[model samples]
Target: MPVVWSAVGAVVFPNVGGWLGGLITVRNIKPWYESLVLPKWRPPNSAFGPVWTVLYSSMGYASYLVWRDGGGFDGPARLPLILYGTQLILNWAWTPIFFGAHNLALSLADIGLLWINVAACGYSFYHINHTAGLIMLPYLAWLTLASALNYCVYRDNSTKIKEVKKDE
Candidate 1:
């Protein structure tokens, strides 16, 4: 049925972002990331995978609810869906920028945009489906925390960041 496919698509979409992020982050966790001057507030690296898994799955399910209730993909739901897609891309970009490129400043900027996109997407989703909007709240919260973490790293490791940037 169409509903089933929509649900599947919803879940799969963010997972694609997750998968791409994993490709960049998994290898870097040991040496590169561990060496960083992370904040005291930072969660353990082990916490990230499980948290993201739940967030991505919930995001997909929320999108599915929006799609199903907003008259399907081709109907009035287009704007919110587009916003969601945009945020998803931004979400995917952050990990690579941070871990792969080791550009904390750029990563912070990227996540700032991501935060805006997520808020807009949540707002748009709220108009289409209330519960759908609610689902995005956790993601928004996480982004807030991530933005802070990124800022801290950038600030605390400015000299190192400069060296890394200069090397590139």
Candidate 2:
């Protein structure tokens, strides 16, 4: 198959999840997400769309590099690609878990797993293609911030906190 097909396939696949997440996000961002006691460090709502656009596109290209140079799923890239997919699924699940279901605890757990999986994915990619590995670094960094945010959100909104506030 042509490289374009592979590249496009890789690129579009992740965005499909992003698009789906957006659908879930749109319905819940107002009244639901807005009502949460988010941390001060949370980025402006406007920042997310652009940031994720870059991250998703970059990660998608990184996957393409691994797929092409590592010889697709039939070869060395198999495990790495699987790691990538696992992380992607975790990534995709975050929106529904947090925004759609308004379950901060489960979202935290999902992103926590995602954080670990992404590190492993990046490591596996590095072994196959250095650039692919390098490309995933930003994603890992973003997850660091995201994981912290998830923890904060979960903590701030925990039942314990709610009970404490009620007692006050």
Candidate 3:
């Protein structure tokens, strides 16, 4: 059935983003990330995986609800789905920009864009399916926290970049 595929697709898409982020993150956890000056409020590294797993799953399910209710991805139905996909791509890009490239400032900017996209997506989803819109709330909350963390990291670690450049 089309509904079934949409459901499966909703979950699969965000998980793929999560998977790509994890791959970039794993290699950088030591030396690069561990050495950074983090905020006192930062959650333990162990907390990230489980939290992200739940968030990604919920995001997928929410998207599925919108798709199923909107009568497939055509006309007005396409906008929310497009916003959803855009946010997912932004989500996937954050880890690589932060961890892989170690550009905290750029990562902060990327997260800012991601936060906007998420809010827009949530609004679009809300227009289609109220529950789907509600599902995005947690993700928006998490992004708020993440944006704060990214800002903190960028502020605290800026000197490290300067130091690296000085040595070069």
Candidate 4:
């Protein structure tokens, strides 16, 4: 019921899943990740941390806005919150699938679903609070880049049999 409980506690802490997941999954993935035939425009590895930090914080705050405006779980915010949580889970799953398990195809599937969930979540949030929905746009933008990168990596790096040469 206190402001601190509502503000500090609510606004400041939603990324533990991401931080911990990255820590565990990324611990030994550098070499293999470095070996991938990435697109010419792929962001430097350092970019991801700062980008995700901002995005996570943005979405976290956005969720709080929706919760405050829509009266949390008992009201209109319920489905939006569930969509937000679902996207969070999908977002958290990507690194483990890509870096830990080395499964590019599956990673693409996960990210694709993540993108859809985020869009749906944003739409739902918009109906409740404009700021909350607007806040999700950057995350969607970043996901756009990430999804394209994932698709390219999977296409270029996955194994394939060379097509037989045809006689002229």
Local distance difference test, each candidate: 0.89, 0.89, 0.91, 0.85
lDDT per residue (tens digit) for residues 23-117 in model 3: 88999999889898999899999989888998999999998898878875874659999999899888999999999999999999999999999
Which predicted model would earn the best lDDT? 3
- Residue-wise C-alpha lDDT for candidate 2, range 9-36, written one tens digit per residue: 8877898899889989988888767777
RMSD of each: 1.6, 2.9, 1.2, 5.2
What TM-score, to 2 decimals, does candidate 3 have? 0.95
Off by over 4 Å in 1: 164-168
Best prediction by TM-score: 3
lDDT of 4 at 70: 91
Sorted on TM-score, best first, the list reads 3, 1, 2, 4
- Considering TM-score, which of the candidate structures 3 and 4 is the better prediction for this target? 3
Query: In candidate 2, residue 153 scores what lDDT?
Result: 78
The lowest-lDDT stretch of 10 consecutive residues in candidate 1 is 157-166
For model 3 the local lDDT of residue 31 reads 83
Q: What TM-score should be assigned to candidate 2?
A: 0.92
Better of 1 and 3 by lDDT: 3
